[model samples]
Target: MTAEPILTISGLNVDYGTGANGVRALRDIDLTLHRGEVLGLAGESGSGKSTLAYAVTRLLSPPGVITGGDVHYHRPGGGEPVDILSLTPDELRAFRWQELSIVFQGAMNSLNPVHTVHSQLTDVLTAHRPGMRAAERTARAEELLTLVGISADRLAAYPHQLSGGMRQRVMIAMALALEPEIVIMDEPTTALDVVMQRQILRKLVELRERLSFSVVFITHDISLLIEFSDRIAIMYGGRIVEQAGAAEIYRDPRHPYSDGLLHSFPALHGPRRELTGIPGSPPHLSAMPTGCAFHPRCGKAFEPCAERVPALAPPDAGQDREVACWLHH
Candidate 1:
C-alpha cells in the first residue's frame, strides 16, 4: 500500500442523545485509510464498528450525533483536504456517491423489492450524471453488472428473482457504479455461507485491484480480516483497542483483548488449539464502566487500568503498531 492517505479521521466521538443521559457510542476514534488499501475493522457486536462507519459517511440517523471529530477527504495530488463534517446537504449529496460509497449491512434486504436491477443501477447514474443519455445509462448499468461477475441478462430481474449472493453483488456493483475513491463496506457478506462469503470477498479484492479504490471493510470475523486486509483495527467498547498490520496482529497481538479475539478463532493450518472466547459480554452503552472499558473483561488488567483510560499509542518508539492498554503503556 502507498503512504498517501485518502481519508483521515481524528478524535471522532459519537453519542446517541444529548446531555448527560446520552449514551456514548464512539469515543476518540483516530483512523486513516491509505490509497489503494483495504483496512479491516473487527470486533464483537456494538463495538462501534458500524457506528464509526455511519459517522464517517454522515449517515447516522435520528438521536445519533457526532459529538466531536474531523473527517477529512484528501483529494488526489494533495490540495486542501475537504472537511467532511462541514459539507452542506447539497454538497454532501454530490460528495457521497462520487467520492465515497457504502454497501450497507444486509445487502440482500437493502435492494428494492419492486424495482429491477437495471432500474436501481441506472437510478444512480441518472441522479449523478443528469446530462447522460438513456442509452449511455443503460450501457453503464449493464457494464456494472458484468463488472461484478453478474450477467447483463439478469439486469431485468427483480430482487426476489436473484439469489442472495447475486443481490449482494448487485449492491457492490452499485457502490462502484460511480468509481468512487473510497468504499465503506459494512458487513457486506453477512448471512451468506462461507463459500459465498469467500467468493464475494475475493471478488471485492479483485475489483479493488482493477479500480484502485480504497476500502474500509467492517466485520465480526477476525479470521477473514487477517486473510484479506492489509491492516486490521480491533475495536472494543466504543474505542480502538489495537491497530496493526494483519500478519503482525495474527502473530503477536499487543492488547489483551486483541489476544483473546485472536484465540477465539480456530487456526486452519497451525497446530490444533482450544478456543477460549472472551470471558464476558460487551459492556452496555448506557451503563459503561469507569476508566478503561475493556478492563472488566481483560485478564491482564492491573491497578492503573481501572483508574485511567490508556491512550492508544505505539509500545515501542519506532513501531507501527498502536494499542490502548496499561500493560503496554
Candidate 2:
C-alpha cells in the first residue's frame, strides 16, 4: 500500500434519530484508506460497519443521519481534496458512480428483477458516459461481464434466471462499470457458500491489483479480512477498537475485543482446538455500556475499562498498531 491517502474520515458521528432521544450509531470514527489498498472493516451485526460505509458514500436514508464528520477524497496526483459532505446534490450524483461505488449486502435485492443484465450494466455507462454510442455501450457491458467471469450470453438473462453467485457478479460488474477510484463492498459474499465466497474474493483481489483502485471491504468475517486485506480495523459498539496490518492483527491483537474475535474463528491449519466464542450478545444501541462498550463482555476488563473510554492509540507493545482498550492504553 502507498503512503498517500485516497480517503480520510475524521471525527465521524452518526445517529438513528433526532433531538434528545437520538441513539448514536457511530462515535468519533477516524480512519484512512490509502490509494490502491484494501482496508477491511470487521465487526458483528449492528456494530455500525454498514453505517460507516453508507455515511462515507452519502447513501444513508431517513432516520439515519450523519450528525458530524468530515470525509475527504484526495484525487489522483496533486490536487485539492474534495469534501464529500459539502458536495451539492447534483455534484454528489455525478460523484457517486464516477469516483466511488458500492456493492450492497444482498445481490438479489440490489439487482432489478425485471431488467436484463445487459441493460443494467449498460445503464451505468450510458448515465455516466453520455457521449458513448449504443454499440460502445453494448461492447462495454459485454466487457464488464467478461471481467467478472460471466458469459456474454448471460447478458440477456433476467435476475431470476441467473444463480446467486452470478447475480453478485453482475452487481460487481455494475460497481466497476465506471471504474471508480474507491469501491465499498458491504458483505458482498455473505449469501454465497464458502467455495463461492473464496472465488469471488480471489477475483476481487485480482481486479484490485489490475485496476489500482482503493477498497473498503466490510464484513463480520475477520479471518477473510486477514487473508485478503492490507490492513484491518475492528469495530465494537460503533467504535473502532483496533487498527493494524493484517498480519499484525492476526499474530498479536492488543485489544480484548480483537483477541476475542480472532479466537471466535476456527483455525484452518492448526491442531484441533475447541472454539471459545465471545460471551453475551452485543450491547443494544439504546443501552450502550458506560465507558468501554466491550468491557461487560471482555475477559481482561479492569477498573479503568469501566471508568473511562480509551482512545485508539499506538500501544507500547508494538509499532504501527492502535488499540482502544485500557490494558493497552
Candidate 3:
C-alpha cells in the first residue's frame, strides 16, 4: 500500500538575487515525500539536487537564497504542520536538525574531527530529546550504533579514527537519533566504493523498513536510484523535466533528458543499446535559454520547445506521471 505524504512541496521557485543580478536555482519544482518512501532526485553535477535538499531542510545560507516556494511538512503524530519557507529565524532554529534531518554529500568532513562519537551523539540527543538522562542517552546512542550495523563500543573513537563507510554510518545514526519523520540524504554514498555503497544502501533499506521515515534521496547515479527509490525526478538546469515510478522511468523515459539518461546506462539484461551522453553542459542560471530550459541539449527539440516552457502534468502514460517537455506537454 502507498503511504500518505509526510511532506509536500509545490511551485517552489528559489532564486539567488534580485533585478539583473538574479540567479534562479529552482523553477517551479514540485515534489512529495511519504512515510516509507524514497523519492530520488537524479541529475548531473550542479543540477540543483543539493539545492532542493537544503531548501526543504531550510538550510540554505547567504547569497544562495529561496526567493519563493512553499515547503509544507507534516510531522508524525500531528505535532505541527509547517510551511518550511515561511518561518522566522527562531522557529527555523527549532525546526532544523530535530524535526528535519539531512545527511550531506561529504559526511566525512561534516563529522566533527575533534569530538568523539559519544560526545557527538549526545549533542543531538541533548538538543532534541532532553527528557533522556545521561544513562538513557548513552543507551539510545548505542542502539543507534547497532542499528547502523556498527559496534557501540566505537562511540569512544573520534571521527578521524573511522573508515569512510564507518563515518557515513555514524552520520546516518546521528540523523536518526531524533527519529525525525523525514531525512534528506544528499549523495550519502558518493565517497564510498561499490561494495561499501551496496552495504550502506542495504542498511538504509532495512532501517527505513524498521523505522518508517520518508526520505528524499539525491544522487547522480540513475542505476542506483532505480534499484532503491520508489519514484524519481530528473532535473535539468534548474527545472525538473521528468518524474515517475522508478521501473516505469527506466522502461519508458518520456523527456529528452530522461531518455538520454537511460541511453547512458548499461542495462544488466538486454541487447546492449548504444551509449550516448547528453551533449551540452547545463546552462548557467543567470543566462538560461528561452522557453524550455533543456531545449539546447534536447535532440528532439523543435520551435514550440524554444518558444514556450512546457507545463508539468500527467504524461501520456495514462497514469500518475508528469514530465515538462513539449512531447508530453
RMSD of each: 0.7, 1.0, 1.6
Global CA lDDT computed for model 3: 0.87
By summed lDDT, the worst window of 10 consecutive residues in model 1 runs over 293-302
Question: What is candidate 1's lDDT per residue for 46-152, written digit by digit as tens?
Answer: 99999999999999998999999899999988899999999999999999989999999998789999999999999999999999999999999999999999999
TM-scores for every candidate against the unseen true structure = 0.99, 0.98, 0.95
Question: Model 3, range 1-329, lDDT digits (tens) per residue?
Answer: 16677888888887777778878999888888776799999999988999898888777776777777688988766666788888898888777777778999887578889999999988988877778899999999999999999999999999889999999999999889988778899999998999999999999999998988888899998989999899999998888888999998988999889888877878778787788988988898878899998988888999899999898888765788898988866
- TM-score head-to-head 2 vs 3, winner: 2
Query: What lDDT would each prediction earn against the true structure?
Result: 0.95, 0.93, 0.87
Ten contiguous residues minimizing lDDT sum, candidate 3: 1-10
> Which lDDT tens digits does candidate 2 get at residues 253-284?
88878888888989999798788889998999
Q: Which residue pairs show backbone clashes in model 2?
A: none
Off by over 4 Å in 3: 1-3, 77-80
**Runs of candidate 2 exceeding 4 Å displacement:** none
